[model samples]
Target chain A: MKLATIRHGATTTAAVAVNGGYLPLPARNLSELLGTPEWKHLVRVATSSHSSPDVIPRTEATLLNPVPAPAKVICCGLNYADHILEMGRDLPEYPTLFAKFADTLTDPDAEITSEHSQSLDWEAELAVIVGTTLRDADEAEAAAAIAGYTVANDVSMRDWQSRTLQWFQGKAFDATTPLGPVMVTPDELDPEAGVQVICTLNGEEVQRGNTMTLVFSCARLLSYISTFTTLRPGDVVLTGTPGGVGMGMVPQRFLRDGDLLRTEIPGIGTLTNTVRIRTRATIQSV
Target chain B: MKLATIRHGATTTAAVAVNGGYLPLPARNLSELLGTPEWKHLVRVATSSHSSPDVIPRTEATLLNPVPAPAKVICCGLNYADHILEMGRDLPEYPTLFAKFADTLTDPDAEITSEHSQSLDWEAELAVIVGTTLRDADEAEAAAAIAGYTVANDVSMRDWQSRTLQWFQGKAFDATTPLGPVMVTPDELDPEAGVQVICTLNGEEVQRGNTMTLVFSCARLLSYISTFTTLRPGDVVLTGTPGGVGMGMVPQRFLRDGDLLRTEIPGIGTLTNTVRIRTRATIQSV
Candidate 1:
């Protein structure tokens, strides 16, 4: 089963994909929908109902970030063993975690813009959405709490990132991170069994790695995070990107204005965003 | 005028500190009140009213964290020049910033506990609260947007903090950071002229520093942050701690269970929290 936050005309709503259309749920978006304990039952009922009167055709609706209002948007760094080895670092015993605000997330196909930094880069990742409250949860409990998985590009600005020891400033620019075309439930998609996380620049493939090489699995990452902070419904945890980011390229290529970036996780979905870089003088007053 | 989120019996309301009492506002807390553009007008009208029918006597109400639902809680690190020099690092060109969650905050007088970490440390700091929407704002605009000032202790778990390069895990434990007895509006308190930030552990002074020596002032920090992310009303920004944290001591001293920790900024109030560290064997399942 897949879930999405669909924008049809002026209103946006939490919706389930059914019969090649979207069946709107009661809440405003997926984040609010996930907060209720009866969300699954509601979705089940909606899917089984005979009425098709309210279902909107897929083409008429636009998909926004599946979970937009997550209170905590935590991202892990260097979880892929291959990526770690290439960067001359050992597989870390603990995940190097940082945070992003809900303001940082944009719609799946939104235009990504930056004015402060010229070195824009891409990192394709698999993002986990929590469905239940979790604190000090063991691996199994964390696994049971999984809501779904989606695709994201942990878009970064190398100039700002290298300014300080922290990566937050570079990674947290508003609307820079594109998340979700749709979220695929764990029952239908399993990263442990291996799913391809792929990234493309324009029309050319640049990154291709399997989730099997992730040093910290989804459950382990969630459990580790729960030890320090509670994971509530709709909270997002972005697993570190697989190998082959622009920063690691031999010539160090970066996204230029008008460059098209696409992030894909086979079972989940893909996010296609165009990069827009505005220089200081030409920067809009926003 | 001072504002606080006061709990009287089973209910909580945003209240104005009046003639030795609290006059209730319409919102549930300061965060909600600040979001409305007419908060100042509303407070003014409430204060000018002759009748005091709804004012809760000071002793009858308990104060929670004044702004409880800030979407962004960004913190600056190593901002004091003196602390930076003592740490053997030159003055940084940019502030080292990090993010914390709303869950990390607690009532000013709450007991702080750590079950996963043995090295509990305290960082006494002055916190800034945003009163309006700010995006790509200048220093003057950022300064004008200040809602008020408050006292906060960025309580950290040194053990968890040292596990990875990022300080987020250690800094983001739920209900560890104590954030206010009340919020003093900017007109009543000024950090530019210098405000002493003092910390005491078990009634003994351990840290003291003046905010005038800060490398990046509150306005500057907010300005820099607004360049990347939009800071909305009720968002928080901690202006970093001074020298003399437990980790910086010659022979490091950590907080033990039942130790009284106090953080004070003269014009604002003080936060009095009791330290409680639980061992793994005794850790509660919550």
Candidate 2:
């Protein structure tokens, strides 16, 4: 079953996607819904409806990122073998971890506005959302903690990222990263068995790889992060992206005004976002 | 005027530090208080009068970290010149920023409980709390954005930190970083001119430096960070630490059970936290 956080007019809430329509769940957002002890059971009830109100036609509904203000948005770097080599780095013995805040999140269809850099780049990734609260969790416990999967484009500012040793400044511009079309449950996905993850800009395929090639799988990353901090419901983990970034291109095709970014994973869905360079007037007005 | 978040039993709220006792403020936390449009005016009134029912005595108050869950907790990697030299690194032109979550924060006087690594290290820093929202702020705007200053120990687990290319894993263990006793208003400080920052373990001075020697001043950091993200009320900016981390020591002294970590700034009060190693039995019970 596919779950999403959607809006109609001013009201936003979690819902189940079905038959080109939405079945509204009785929760404020995906995070709050996942926080309940009976979330799994609730989702079961949702799939088998008790006359769920057709909240809105899915086409007319405005979909928000599943977990907008997650407790944490942990990201891994250099996890994809080809991507690692493309960037001229070795397959790391350990995950190179970093973070992004809630302010950095933009909706699936939102426009990417660059106020800091002209070198905005894209990294398409298969993302994970945690469901249970676990600390010092072993591999099995970590596996049991899986809530679902989603899509994200880790839109980055190449100039800022490379300026300092730490990549945070370049990666965390407000409302820059796109994080969801919908969340597909783990039972519907075997990403570790090689699910295709692809990125395209202006109808040209730039990045293509399989999750099976991930140096560190989702379960291992979760268990490793849990060793240091508690992994709670609504926390997001962005598994690293594959190769073919614009930075690795010969002339370096950076994002410009009106560039289209499309990311797709077959079982989950597609995310289409247009890039718009904030004009001098538009920037000054804010 | 000094503002604090104090807990007595189950309840916690923003309060004014009066003579020997605290006066409860209308806001729930420092974040909410700072969010008000007339915060400066409100604080002016708070400092003057009203028969405020006596809250906890200042000395007896059970203070929590001033901002329990800020929108962001950004930490600097290397800002102090002398300390930067001690760490065997050249001066950086830009601030090396990283992140920590609310889960990693503990009360000022709380015990440092570690369930993971034994190579815990100390990094004493002067912390800034943002009061107003700003984006691409200039120097003057940055100065106005300052809410106040406080003390923090960016305690790290060196083993976990060095295991990976990124430093986040080791820096973000749950309940490790100590953030506040109270927030001292900017009107009371000359941070740019420098304020003495000292760190002592078991009453022996292990690290000492002045905020004046910071490679990036507080106002400059605020302005620089505002370029990428909005600086909201209660967001914390840890201005990095001076040199003298345990890793730089001759034999490398690491934190152990019963070790006392004390941090002090002349304008801000002192923070004393004791370290404890959680046993395996205690870890599993949770």
RMSD of each: 2.2, 3.1
In model 2, which runs have C-alpha deviations exceeding 4 angstroms? Answer: A50-55, A279-286, B52-55, B278-286
Backbone clash tally (model 2): 1
User: Model 1: how large is the Cα RMSD against the reference?
Assistant: 2.2
Q: Which residue pairs clash in candidate 2?
A: B83-B243
Pairs of residues clashing in candidate 1: none
Q: What is the TM-score of chain B alone in each candidate?
A: 0.96, 0.94
Candidate 2, residue A175: the lDDT equals 92
What TM-score do all the candidates reach, one by one?
A: 0.97, 0.94
Q: Write the per-residue lDDT of candidate 2 for residues B188-286, one digit (tens) a residue.
A: 887888898899999999889998899889988888888899988888999999888898899998998999999989878888999997644332211
* Cα displacement (Å) at residue B185, model 2: 0.4
Which candidate's lDDT is highest?
1
lDDT of 1 by residue, A1-286 (tens): 9999999999999999989699999898999999989999989988888377889899998999999999999999998987887667888988999999898999999999888888889999999999999998999999999999999899998877877778888889999999999988999999999999999999899888888888889999899899989999999999998888888878888899999999989877889999988875443221
Could you tell me the lDDT of residue B17 within candidate 1? 92
Q: List runs of model 1 lying over 4 Å from the truth.
A: A280-286, B280-286
lDDT by residue (tens digit), candidate 2, A1-286: 7889998778998888887587778787788899888988887787686463554787778888988868799999889999999888888878999999888888998999886587889999999999998787887898889889999999998888887778888788889889888888888897888888999999999998899999988888898888888889999999989999999889887898899999988898888999988754332211
